[model samples]
Target chain A: MTRMNERLKKIIIIVVGLLMILLMAISFGGRERITAVESQLGSFIAPVQRFFSQIGNFMDEKTEPIINVLNYKSLNESLAKENEMLKAQVVSLTMAQKDFEELNDLKQSLHYVERSDQDNYISCSVIAKDIGNWFNMFTIDAGTEQGVTKNSTVINGNGLVGLVYEVGSNWSKVISIIDHKSSVGFEMLRVTDDYDGILSGTTNYELVGELYDTQANVHVNDYIVTSGLGMYPKGILIGQIYELVDDRDLFLKQIKVKPAVDFKKLNKVMVIPYDEYEEEITTYLP
Target chain B: MNKIFVFLMAIANFILMSTLFQQFRVYGVLANLCIVFSIIFAILFSEQHGYIFAIVSGLLQDTFLGKVLFVNTIIYIILIYVTVRIEKIMFKGNDLTPIFLISMATIAYHLIFFVFMFLLQSTIPIHQLLMHVIIEVILNSVIGLFIYRVVFKNVFGYKLGDYNA
Candidate 1:
């Protein structure tokens, strides 16, 4: 009787293992919306994560002062130099703003329709990050309760952070742009709109891209922004190009990008809810 | 009573890994506390207890991450089973036993995870994946040894040389 039970237990384990593998296959392929069970689980854990995250913040706050004290001299030197440069830029920007306002008034008088970009955003703080080192996903405090939805654009002061991949009642999971699974459509800032490419994240948490046309006038240090395609909206800064890999064999212009957002220190983010009706589909150039 | 306490510890470790331990990342790799705890449980207790702890920890991690359920759970269950089998063959009452077991478990965990991810069409390069695995192994070994000693002395109420088998 004991031998029979042992055999039965082994069979059950194998059967269950196969079923889990099958479920994982479906979940990965379907990439379906979050299920009710997952949503409930997320809601339950969100507050606990928030509490722990607060404790972490407190610890960092306490330790930061000591670390800053050690490097205060060098920090002060750099800040003074940067402050002077920023003061000069502010003066030039003020003059440019006056000219831009004058041109805007003239355009309005000519009966040009005013274009408004994104205006709705829900702010949230990062509560937890993925336990695995493989993916660059994190949990935030806001969720569908706060108008956050799946595929919503998440950004911070620096630049584009990522998109909300899963949403719960009181929390949401965001997949950052540095995740290997992320891909964004981008165009060079201030360059021809026709010159666009797809930037993707690698396992090393770095961004790499390939332009659609090899002949496109692209170079290092050129800024890249969302082309208003796919999940991300237009004009959100993605990153700047740092390296342009020349591949004559495949006739592809591969390039490397440095993302603007410092993902390691992500604290707060703004979520622009995904809306199909409000999406403005217009040609960016010509 | 011990089972319940172990289950709660699993939850605590999972929560801490996702929140507090993230701040302690070295070389862009965070030590997976869940894996470390799972291995420790398997080494210190019976195989059956290890299996139960694995399921709880793995489920908590998978649910919190909001990914496909049971992926981590399955990997962890297999890990527990392997650890138990290896324990029977090797001398486990040594100081370096936990570190050795943890290094092996971390490698296996990543290998299985990478295979599943590759099947899902992930685009991680081979060289980068190997580098990540190497760093994680080292990190897990160091962190795992620290945790194992604490669990040994506090939870099990065992002295340094009191461990048998």
Candidate 2:
């Protein structure tokens, strides 16, 4: 009788676990806001994560020179080899700078505004990163208290990083563009015409894009930016196309892209509060 | 008292894994200290205690990540259950038990997580998942052995492989 009771208890536990999994699977699509309990728990844990993160950074900074010194012979050889290549690269870069300046002047005259220029950015330090590689997500120190809200665009100096999905009092969870579940509306930044496309992340931490027009003229090294049709704002640099995929469908022009942000090294990010630019962003549509 | 200490350590390990251990990724996969801790704690303590630790740690992870809730809880529960079952068959205090169990548990964890994501219609490359499991198994085994010995020694007041002593 006692053994039967134990078996019944095990069955009950299994049923409860299955129910929870089923509920989570059903609600997987729409992750608008996290529960208050989750938010509070995250808020409680953020400070401790921040403390440990800082200590890790401090230890890395202190040990880097020692590591460098230990590898001084190899480092010196590499530096000498790089110096020769840099000398030739600098001359070409100087020439390119002249052309860049001309383009900048022309852009300024045309009153071309960049999405990043809008001043609703709240800078925050990364406290914790997603423990698993399945999702490229992180928690930042800034939250609703610091003007960060759900669906806000997160960017580093390089470019579009991700979007904030959950917010607490002083912390927010950011899902990066490289996460498999994340998708962005992007457009090719061509001089003649722009072709809209949808870019989604892959499990291998890479971006893949599909253009709406099958006959679009796309080539390697073409620049891609956010199309302002989704959670991200307009004109934010997403990445550049690297390789084109041969798809048998013939209706979608698919290509592989290299992301602008180095997700592995993310430390600090600026959040563009979605509500602050809601009105201005809506004007971009239609 | 032991349960409370173990619970606190779980939280501390979670913070360390998501913060410090994140920097030391080998081939884009970091060793999940929470998994290692849960497996080792389950082996050291009673099966009932193991389930309790799994629930707490798993909930803490899902709460902190703010993703599909209870995903980790379900995975960890399965892991603890499997570990407890295997413990009954093998030498309970054997040193190789945890190394083997952790390796298997890590693979199971990823496979279960992949299944969950696939059910949600997330696209995960099979090769990428394989690579993640392979690297994580190696990492978790090495790290899990160390954590196992530490917990075993501290809780039982003797080193592993010296159960009679």
Candidate 3:
């Protein structure tokens, strides 16, 4: 009987080992298939994701009042400072508006002039950021129900934040330009010449744009703007050149650009609707 | 009563670790409180109960965040088994052994996770990877020590003589 029990144990061990090996092999072979299934499953569970996100946001909102009560003095000081900044900005904008009217006459002589019609912007508020070693994403409160769609451009008052990757009923995920997979056609604002580069995120919360080719003539502090590609509108600010490299041994001259939008301070955003810009660009392109 | 308490604690710890404590990432690593809970549950409960709790916790984790199904459950079962085996030899309830055991268990958990990700062709940098493991282990150990005191002294009312039986 003892020998029979030992044989049973051996058989069990061998079976388990074989099963483990088979499982590992299947996992290796079907990774893409598994990921596709998972993503599709995620889409199906978008309502649950939205529910959890809403709960988290509600918790944060409830705590905010308590935090405000505890830090009332500091909050007041911050509000005062913000009010002063807004007043100064209002004065400056008034002056700029006058200057823009004067320059409207000179704009006729320019070769490629594009005017911004601001009627198509849908406002949104950022709810949460998915920042970890594995994933870098941000969630905004607007989604397909609110006229947001995949590939829609998200911008703040400063500049481009990211593009909408996934849209649920009431929430959307923005794949920030800082992510490794993000690429954009950018050009120097001073020259209006086109250059292509990829935007990548560093360990630190910084977006670095690496421009390819040595003859791009990009210098430190040069304003980087989008290339007016059919996707992104022209003249939207990308970032400012942070680092410039010019070594003979290197294959491409690279420049690190610091994004204009402060993601940490992100609270509100504007989503550029498809119809208005798409109509304008399609007329211009083909 | 004990089974219910363990199950509740496991779920609570999982939720807090994934949602609340996730915001406190130190050098891109957050403490794995689930590891601490698994170790404590293994030490406090029967071996069969410990294994059951590990599977439950792992399944919950898998449902929420796991990319590879069953991997976390298998690792957690191994962890419970190892901890239970060690408890048999050095079963002192009051010494620093529990802290040391939890620290080692967490480290092993992280190492296994790293190897799994590496096998899956993840591009995590070596420095960041090492930092993640060390930070999580240290944080879990510190938190586990305080938690151990509370669970044994207050929650279970476990005495020194309880282990001998």
TM-score of each candidate? 0.89, 0.84, 0.61
DockQ of each: 0.64, 0.61, 0.22
CA lDDT scores, all candidates in order? 0.81, 0.81, 0.64
Candidate 2 docking DockQ: 0.61
In every candidate, what fraction of the native interface contacts is reproduced?
A: 0.66, 0.62, 0.04
Candidate 2, residues A22-76: lDDT per residue as tens digits?
A: 8778556435666688768777888889999988777767876886787998989
For residues A5-87, write the lDDT of model 1, one tens digit per residue.
Answer: 76886787789899999887777622436678877877777788889988887887788888789799998999999899889
Best by DockQ: 1
Interface CA root-mean-square deviation for model 3: 5.6
lDDT of 3 by residue, B36-145 (tens): 77787667656656766677767655533443455567677768767877888875576486778888888777666667667766444556456656776788888888
Better of 2 and 3 by TM-score: 2
lDDT of 2 by residue, B1-165 (tens): 277877777777788888888768888888887778777777777876677767887887776674677888888898888788788788757778988999999989888988887887774777867888888899899998987888788887888898479
Tens-place lDDT digits, model 3, residues A135-202? 34566667666887667778889988877765556656676776544567776776346676655665
CA error at residue B49 for candidate 2, angstroms: 2.9
Ranking by DockQ: 1, 2, 3
User: Global CA lDDT of candidate 2, please?
Assistant: 0.81
